[model samples]
Target: MTRSTWRTRIGFILAAVGSAVGIGNIWRFPWLTAENGGAAFLTVYLLLVVGVGVPGLIGEFVIGRRSNRNPVGAFDELAGRWFRPLGAVALLASTVILSFYSVVGGWILRYTAASTTGAYFTAPQEYFAAIDYGLGAVGFHVLFLAMTVAIVYLGVERGIEVSTTVMVPGIVLLFGALAVWASTLPGAGGGYDFYLSLDVAYLRENLFSVLPAAAGQALFTLSVGAGTMLTYSSYLGEDRSLAADGTLIAVLNTAIGVLAGLVIFPLLFSLGVSPGQGGPGALFVSLAGAFAELPYSRLVGVVFFGVVLLAALSSAISILEVLVAYLVDEHGLSRERATLGTGGLFLVTGSIAALSPAVFALLADTLANVVLTAGLLGFLLFDGWVLGRLAREEYARGAGPIARLFELPWYYAIAVVLPVFLAFTLVTGVGGILGIGISTRGAAAVAVLGVGGAILALRRHGVPG
Candidate 1:
């Protein structure tokens, strides 16, 4: 019997991009910018997306195609037993990610139904506030989880690939229409100015303030740190170039993210709905208000929510696939058993997030950022320290000349510098969680020492790729 492979390069690209360009782009990005410094925030975000995000994405691909297994199996195959914990960490991170991911997907599903029923037309803010925090959200989350489980149980090629093929087109079409409509809204020009207009002085003054947020956005937007990409890449057969494919996937995902902002901000500006008061609820509260008041908005509301639902499902499918692949390949479980087992556990985890808004807030906010950064650091250490020469060889398998040259410098940065930065962010993040402002300089030193310690250990007794 033959092993399963991605149906086509186009399908793989679309599925991968679809996973990246989801709730974070539509539900998170605009608000993060507005919270920090608006246009200046946007400027910083673009820089990180290009400078760090793209290259990091390629690094994940290099791991995946080289190992051709789940994150746990991939690490176990590529490195010695001393590094098994890193693979476990990746699996744990993915599981943690999917928990909150499903909660947000529930929001999209609830909104989709609300759009049809005109639930928000009567009292947009109150409706959103009520449903977003309590039992209503829990129910919708279960619905979303069930849908995701159904697909994963169906197997990857037919379930994930096929649904993503349909969903991606719908997301594009709805966003295009929403952007067009936003331009005609009376006060939308202000939103565009607020979101798009550059503030060079502000950026220069608060560059440090925005760096972590921008970096977080870049990581989340590409879905890089969670091993979703690693899992996807593991199935590759090396028929195509990983570097080129990674670049294209990153570009398309970033483009859609920018487009989501274009559509969302303009509508908020036009409607006189401030994007901040609602926090994460801004997407729902603001859009609901617009639909309730604007001319012919009921029809538009249906289209917009439908679009969001499609995008949410595409991402949810990818999250489930990570675990589904693990169960079948690692444990020799049937696809059905894996899907049900993981999905049931997520229901409990996601319900905790839904019922306890504060927990949900932590999961969606600072805690999530910290976890992802740490997970990425783990992957980098595995690749650059534990798997250095071997990773370079895997990267070279189908890469071109320019990419080939980047192999060494990329190694130095990942092995040495990237981990330091990741550790510093983790400390700052822990500080934020605890409410402190101790010396960032000290944090930087700790980052360097931490990475150095790990590298020395790797050399002495850790896994060999």
Candidate 2:
């Protein structure tokens, strides 16, 4: 059988953009920006996205294209069986993320349907609570999972590439229009001030407190850690610039996120809604209330929620594709069969998350962060150490002069700097998740140094890539 590959370079980029521009962009980015000093957080977040996120994204791309295999097979093929456990970390991240992610996708689907008939406009908070965890949520989760499964079952080039080609452009166009509409609302200037106004004092004083969250959000927005990028890149059949592609994905994702803030914050302020008080349900509740009072309430609600639905479905499709690719490559399962098996697994797991808020929080918030950080850490280490010299060779394969210029430096950063940075973030993030208070800076330093020492020793022993 012929191996599958992306039909065009644009297809791959769009699919990745679709993956990156999901719930994180639409929901979490705005919330984090508001809570962390608005424009100050955005500045730090953009810095991290470039300095760390893009390099890590390139590392995943190199691993995927070099091996042309799923994470487990890629690691085993490139590094040896002993290093395959690192790939397992990625697989684990994908599973944990999609379990709860599908649940949220279901919520978006529910909200989209509700907006058509103004179901939630009466009491948005109560509606969210009622549907947040129950059999109803489980049913919707299954529906969302079904949508994801159907897309993955269509084969890579036909299903994923084609769908994302349409979905990504639609997402950008719709959000752009929403941002313009939102800007015309009464008192929208206050929202702009809050969102774009940088408070240097807040950033200077709260740097440590804000860095980990920013780092985590940077990774999340780019869809780097859970093998989704790796899996997506594995389908490449041509030599395109990985660095160039990674940069574009990061830029577009960040732009849409900022645009989302433009739409969300302004609309909320226009409606006299306090964004900081909305919590996780802010998008649904406050926005729902705003829509209820607006002149073209029903039309606005439909368009707004429809954009989120597209965003959610596109991202869920990418996450589900990772496991399906694994089964197809590693287990020799047919694409349809593999998709069914993966979907079946998620049906049970997602239903659990849908029915139990505690389980959803555990997977989505605590475990997902730790696993994604670990997964990216492992991939970068392999890129820097195991693949070492060869990693650069692969990176330079389809490159222009500009991409070729940074080849060696990219190597060092991915190999040395990023692993250490991610190691620290992983430690602090896990500590936060587990409700433990440790000296975060000290522990992170010790942990990164320990790993660095081990890498140095391994190189001394003459390990081959």
Candidate 3:
């Protein structure tokens, strides 16, 4: 039996965008901005999106489209046996990500239900604190993971393509509508200024602190370097241009991220909910509070959490796909077995995160960044070093003359600059996570030289993808 592919280009792009634009954008984006100097973080994030995210997006596609295999096989097929370790690492990273991601998805689903039931009417934050702990969140996490397993086990055509096509448009429409509605609220202007204004001094002082975050968001938001992109691209039929598809996905994801900020900040500001202080609960508690105090409040709560549920589900599907593909490819497990096995693992791991705020905070912040950045470093190395020649050729295939011109720059960036940047980010992000933010200068020194050492090691091996 042949692997199923997307029936249309629109389906492909929408599915990619669906995975890219999710809880990461809504819940995480606003929070990260609040943590890392609001507007300053946004500026650097935008810069990295174009620089790091887009190329990494193309690189994943090249590997996937070229081999027409799942992520593990794709690298092994092109970059030889040595590259398989990196492929395995990407596979593991996705599984780790999904374990936590699905729990968050569950939180969204519960909030959506609560919104409909008017649960946020009295003490929104307190309500969140009560429900978002221990057995409650664990139960919800299991349910969310089960839903993800069911859809992904159905395979790409019915599972990913159809689901994303429907949900992606719905999410976009809902957020846009929410933004318009939020704009009418009293304090919406303050929210807009806070979110969109440029802060040059803040940017200069905290560029390094924010760099890893923006890069991680770019990577996480795009679902790039996670092997999900590679898995999705593996189904490509070559009738579509890889460059064009990647660009559309990146643009849509970025647009949605900005759109989410527009919707969230306005609502929170309008309610006098200091977005800076809200943490992960802010999007839920803050917005729920806003709805409670506003006219026709119940309707807005339904709309907001409904949008989040859709976004969360879409992204969860991508996360589930990673483990599913890896199991089916590497271990020769059936889709059903793989999803079950993966879900079973997450059941325990996610419970830990659910029960402990410390762990969840770590996963959501520094730890997630470290793992993802490290994984991307491994991925870019596999592409640039191990799969170097084949990546160039694959990137050129079905590419327009205009996009083809970017091949060398893409190569150098992924091959040289990105790995160093990733290394710096890995250390710096870890440092901050460990309460060592003041040591960024020392971290920067290591990031510079260590990444170079990685490139030299690759050169010594003469890896050729």
TM-score for candidate 1, residues paired by index: 0.94
Candidate 1 lDDT over residue span 296-350, tens digit each: 7767787788778778878877877877777787888888888899998999999
* Tens digit per residue, CA lDDT, model 2, 68-168: 98989998888667777878888898899899989988888898888889998888778888888899999889998998899889988889889889888
lDDT of 3: 0.81
**lDDT per model vs. reference:** 0.80, 0.84, 0.81
Window of ten residues with lowest summed lDDT in model 2: 456-465
List ranges where model 2 is wrong by over 4 Å.
454-465
In model 3, which range of ten residues has the least summed lDDT?
456-465
Write model 3 residue lDDT over 332-442, tens digit each, in one string: 888878878877888888888888888887677766676677777887876787678877888888889888888899888988888777787788777777777546678
Leading candidate by lDDT: 2
Task: Please give the lDDT score at residue 62 for candidate 2.
Answer: 95
List the pairs of residues colliding in candidate 2. Answer: none
lDDT of 1: 0.80
